[model samples]
Target: MSMEGFSKVFEMYEAFRELSLSRHSIREFRDTKVPQDMVDKILELAATAPYASGKKNWDIKVIDDTQTIQAIADSIEAYTTALAPKIREDFREGFIEYSQSFIAFKDAPLLLIPTFKVNYSLSLMVEDEAIKAWERDNYVKSIATLSMIIHQGAHALGLGSCYMTGAVIAQEQIKKIIKIKPRHDIAAIIPIGFKKER
Candidate 1:
């Protein structure tokens, strides 16, 4: 390869390394709107991530509506509130505090829910329930891979995002609000927007 071409490749590698190392989860965001095109771009980049067993097996649900986002937040808050009492008295307060992070996406301009379909192609062939269950869950790993790509793609675009698992605690409520199919399951809730100035 020519020196110029090698230099360009090294520069790209350095940039990717910097992005990977510097990026951190963003819990708060400014009200500035995230354009649909930008959202589409991130997902486009995310689609390039490799899929397991040559099956895409995953999809993303985008929520940009303010009211609907708020409703999702309220549901999480209510569910956690009800769940608080079940915790030991000393731990209840801490649990409530921790639950707040689950709904941090309420303030962001866009929310992405990466979902995976249960694929039984490999699992169904197995007679052992244990192996079957493992194979079933393996399909779900695609969403996590997709989510990380989405995060890096957003970061490359100067946007901030958080990969949230806590929100999945209220997946049933979230599913009703988003009208997701029964076979689909929540992988993670990602909120994206411009970072709020400290």
Candidate 2:
């Protein structure tokens, strides 16, 4: 290759490399609305994530209603109320800070919950032990792969997101609010919006 050709190729490669590394987890967001088209594109790209047995076992629920958001916040507060005294104190200060961080979900325009269904069952028979182990490993790997793709796609679109696993811990409350099926479980709650300029 000529020197000029080599330099051009290197520049393009570096640009793409930087794009991949530039992706980050954004917690704070502005009050701007995230366009529906952009949201659709993020989910579409996230759907390209690989799956075991070529089965897509993931589902997403987008929550944007004011009533629903208030219900979720209430549920979280109620759940947190039962914590041990010491544990509660430890999280009290942090929880206040965290609460402020999530003000974007209510103040901004979008919030999403991603759910993963684990259909692979482990048999009790000794003969099925190896198969069960393989299935378990495959199930976890597939879910992790899906999350990475989804997060990366969101970042690429200039949208800010925070993966709230704590929200998933309130699965029962979330399920009730969202009316999810019995087989489905909350995986992560990703609050998305425009990043507030620092």
TM agreement with the true structure for every prediction: 0.93, 0.75
Candidate RMSDs in Å, in order, are: 1.5, 4.1
Cα error, candidate 1, residue 24 (Å): 1.2
Consecutive 10-residue window with the lowest summed lDDT within model 2: 99-108
The residue-by-residue lDDT of candidate 2 on 1-198, one tens digit each, is 999999999998897687678877776678677888988998887788898855677777777675787677677656655443446676677775554443334444577777766666554444586787786667656766767776777787888776667665557876777866568777766778888889
Q: Candidate 1: minimum summed lDDT over ten consecutive residues — where?
A: 118-127
Best by TM-score: 1
TM-score of 2: 0.75
Clashing pairs in 1: none
